[model samples]
Target: MDISINYTRGQDDPKSGPVKVGWVVSDVEAPVIYDPPRRVNSRDARREHGKSASRCPAVLGLESRYFEIACPFDINIGFDRDKDGRPHLRNLAGTSGPIRASTLGKRLSITNEAEWRYPDRPIIQLKLPYIFLADEPTYITQLDAYLHYRKTPLPGTIFGGRFPINLWPRPLMWAFEWHDVSKPITLRRGDPLFYCQFEFDNPERSVQLIEASMTPELKSYLEHISSAVNYVNQTFSLFDAAKRVRPQTLITPARS
Candidate 1:
């Protein structure tokens, strides 16, 4: 069945277009940032320094409710992979509603997308901050941003440094990059920091859900990526909170 996916700057418009996000990845070339060793504070004033003064800043130390599980009319359409890379069920009559790895294809292309679209609700309200980036202020229509938000980082890591002509190697500060969230543009959240809303169709046809996480490794990656974006944004232009408040710069000429 064909599904109409609509993204809106505001909830009222259905033809606003689907939201999009961007993600970039290249083998193992992404940079990685790590903190230097912690500085040992002197417990006693009269004693000599226990260690040398060279060190980096110590690592700055650092839901939700519910929703329905829709039962699709045809469970076979829900997922399409079995252990032998085959279909386990012929129809929805006898199959369970919950999606399992066994019922998914070998590649992890879009298993979760089907699950998000079963209800046909047309107005799904997601109470999570799943949005990562956007091209427009009112709505999002970039799939890359969404995908970047969903991307997962692999385990291994590496660091980078500069090399000078005079010296074999030069001192370079640490920076971090992720194979997953490559280069995110902007991330926003409400004051409560707990809840946001997503509207899905009651008779949901097609959509996707990507969970935001605070996993130690994921957090580190996000922090580095965000910091990098902030650095760029700051260098290019000041973050004008006023623009958000007063977007209209069109001023009328004063009457003499």
Candidate 2:
């Protein structure tokens, strides 16, 4: 099943072709360390170490993919201290070098091409190369932004929330909020700040939850599991015990 994503390029969009947007799995390189190290000599620790060494296929299974939205240009977001003593957040971008609020009205003709104002909050806005338009029966929600996983520290925090998308006539713009209004937040060009996840939402589909008693096969399996001294050893050693099931022959089907 293929879902199409249509978009319109902004007039000041520097890129020549359509924006490259696709599915991406969570960055597994971003390690999740457990608090209070597991006991080195414990049975649980040994099991965990074995799983970790094997690359834990069950844990690495992909249930969902994040949509990466990159920043088009270098933008400096901060309050205009030169203008007034009062704090006011603003976004400025330049054509050549690093963009700042002081250099807004100086060199570049600041056009509203690669940016748009939110209907509710005029102060908070987003900059992008193009506007997306999708008529499919799909829903998109904001996932954790990529800034969280970046090694470099951000000057300011990114603000985002969940929003459903359908066959809306207007284009979809990335939402942003500057946590530090007094200080400047510079997001370099091609930096991925917006992360989202998409799911098919069929209105016609009905879902219901139900519970049932275990079958005889399931009961027998549970009895065997209860009798086992080590669960992992019993489960994973099946191929070696019977010589029938091969790990190399096991295949998991691709999800849409």
Candidate 3:
């Protein structure tokens, strides 16, 4: 089955825009490295196999479908002292044009920052060129900063949201924690700042919390292995008695 998200371009958006919304090519340049060179030595067969073994199947599953959202403009963000001597965030400069950064109660707003503006918070908003419309429910999440962009850590935490196509009409906000009062950071144009993966929601199923009763056998087992040291020594020892019978396999499985 073919699945797709519909996008409506903003009236003022350029035809040759640098930022992309949905699926994108892997070769695009970004500040972060998502998939690093797994193989260290191409000639060493053992080392090459070891690297392949270390890859996480879950990461590989979503890698190709992950949507990378890039920075629309070149901008600098820095810290400065307010009137009360407390630290605050300020927008230094932007290459694309004048960017506005303002505070909306507890949350900081970045406005004129993008092509499309939100109705409520016009002061600080990301103007996404395309308003994403899906046939079903979808989710958008930020890329892992520690894993991908370790050198240039995001000053704030990334926020994710679940959107139901028919009910939710507004685009997602590019929210961050914005509490780091340390050094300044710069995001160049076309920098891969955000990443998102989508899933189709099942309306038939609703989330619910239910109390679970433990079985007598499970309770007895838990009571018997309550001691941390004893449990580790008996069952989770680094050198186990089972290993003596048949050594664990360290080799990577050969590709089929």
Put down candidate 2 lDDT per residue, 1-256, tens digits, no spaces: 7796444445575332322222211112211210111111112323446556334544322211444555545666555534544334555444445545454333212223224243222234553322222223345555446423555455444455543222211122355444444455666655665665554533222211111223343233333433333455444344243222212211122243
Q: Lowest lDDT 10-mer window, candidate 2?
A: 33-42
lDDT (tens digit, per residue) of candidate 3 on 1-256: 7696544445575422222122211222331422221211112223345457335455444354455555655557765656975444567664434444532112234433242233322223333422232222344344433334546665555555553322222333455444354645566655655565444433222212111223343233323433444456434342233224321211112232
lDDT of each: 0.24, 0.37, 0.39
Instruction: By TM-score, rank the candidates, best first.
Output: 3, 2, 1
Q: Give the best candidate by TM-score.
A: 3
Q: What is the lDDT of residue 76 in candidate 1?
A: 26
lDDT of 1 at 120: 23
Off by over 4 Å in 3: 1-58, 81-89, 93-127, 139-147, 201-256
